[model samples]
Target: MPVFLTIETTCDETAAALVTDQLEVLASVVASQDKLHQQYGGVVPEIASRAHVERILPVIHETVQRAGISLADIDAVAVAYTPGLAGSLLVGVTAAKTLALALGKPLIGINHLQAHIYACRMAAGRDVFPCVGLVISGGHTCLYRCRDPLDFELLGTTIDDAAGEAFDKVAVMLGLPYPGGPSIQKAAEKGDPHKYAFPRALLDDPNTLDFSFSGLKTAVRYAITGPGRHDPSQVKLSDQEVADLAASFQEAVVDCLVGKSFRALEITGFHRLCVGGGVAANKRLRTRLEEEAARRNVDLVIAPLKLCTDNAVMGAIAVEKWKAGVFDDLYLDAEPGVVRRSSALIHG
Candidate 1:
């Protein structure tokens, strides 16, 4: 029962967690920078990185305290160092490396994307590999063939904006709050999903698993504030109008996500499907997935709502690497772009 302390600062959240090799989350803490970035309606990298610098240590300390564990009880220090903001990723990687060195523990660099999928394993309390893993978030919309804990084969990725990004942009258009996912979900609850038939990108292509939300986003923009459309700010829109737009947009995104995910399962021939990331927390998306999975008789695991968003608890995926002796040296550096494997490390 080796316990690992994990840190995550991939984007706007500074998080830390304590978890056992068995995938039990002893404690988890996340410091959100949503208020800091809310005014901007999106994440500002420099602001996010600085916020992480200010909050990372405090988060880790709180997590350890909540877990009721001393530093000596930790077996390894893990951090998600890839596929994230360069400056933010650096904050977590540097913290983990220092802790591992100071405590004489093994250092494990976790892939943020893979850990998102691993959140399924953590929640399921069992193995969930050899499945189609769909990661839908603000920055990434991709599917992978997860053959094992550490082995993932790239299946399809977004050619344009991710599903979550579209939600944010559309939320801004509707004059909603910065985190469009929740705001839109709330609005859609009162609106009509069929008010507008938004485009479902790549839905017609059965062979392709990649997603395209940019077109959908653009369509929403034109529908609301295009040439002939009244300016959103100048025109007083009825509550029903706002709700309708939100509902329609959400329905379109959910349709695409559910449809493609099932298609991925079909192509992979895997009865189990795992979905992760912030967008996966959407209630509509969850309902549609559940309905479809039931109809198809496929075992599905949506990362628990809390784990659906970025958090260090998912970093417990590092335990798999710890057991396999897959350790990273102190020289490991943060990788901002998408990377398939750990060999994409740069010495610090």
Candidate 2:
């Protein structure tokens, strides 16, 4: 089996993995910078890049060791080089390029967002193509028509803040932790999702698949701050109030996500839906999607919790390209913007 080394530093996680041509992950190692970025309430690019610089080599070393493979055994080097923070991406790209040059191996460039959807395929251990793919994370909330491992056509995208970003911002208002998905999920456990009828933005239009979370986020801000210059430190609420708000917000976000996803399936005439990205790890989102998928008779495949968030295991998506004999030049660069293409659908 042809084995490849994959590196992923698209964000705060310095991760590396070893995988075979058969999509079997032999070893995966990640060094999270959660503690470093926790105090900032969000990721600081400079800090993330610095952390990646410090941890990338060690992470790769551990992955190789765990895989029980020597440097000479790696057939190629794969790295997520697109759709991420430029600095963070540079660290991984540079490392991969150096390894490819030093070890005389091929370099494969992976799209971070595409890799997220590919996680579903890795977990399913089968072909999940020609399905609707949903990627929801702090930086991305978009739907795609994934025809193959490398072929993705954009169906819709968020016009404002991503769902995970809304969670983090609302968490900040509620004095929760930096990575708000889990925090809000924990707080919402005891609260009522129906306490407040939070707006499900852009759900009224059947023709549009795009998402809008900015208005909902604004509603939450006004509810807590009441149209004034707000100080997160000064905002105070009872534990119950906090929980209720969290529940309500989370419900709204989930409604938008699941609703739009099923709508995409209906429009595309696809029965299979694959979901990935960090927010895919949310317990509530997972449960709600599972229920909806069952009711609507749509097959749902979500990335495993460990693979939901950014990691090098997904970077093994490069294996697909490797099989296709796709390789990147040393001059490949990182793309910080969301990757998208014109809609493939045609209308009268």
lDDT of 1: 0.89
Task: Look at candidate 2 and tell me the lDDT of residue 293.
Answer: 94
Model 1 agreement with the true structure over 1-348: per-residue lDDT tens digits:
899999999999999999988788899999999999899889999999999999988998999899998989999999999989999999999999999999999999999999999999998988898898999999998888887999887777888898888899889888899898999999999999999989998887865777899988877777777756755666556889899999999999999888888887877788999999999999999999999999999999999999999999999889999889899999999989863423211110
TM-score of 2: 0.97
Query: TM-score for all predictions?
Result: 0.95, 0.97
Clashing residue pairs found in predicted model 2: none
Identify the leading candidate in terms of TM-score: 2
True-structure RMSD, every candidate: 4.0, 1.3
> Candidate 2's residue-wise lDDT over 147-187, tens digit each?
88888878888988988888988898899998999999999
Candidate 2: global Cα-lDDT?
A: 0.90
9 Cα displacement, candidate 2 (Å): 0.6
| Candidate 2, residue 4: lDDT | 91
Q: Give the residue spans of candidate 2 off by over 4 A.
A: 343-348
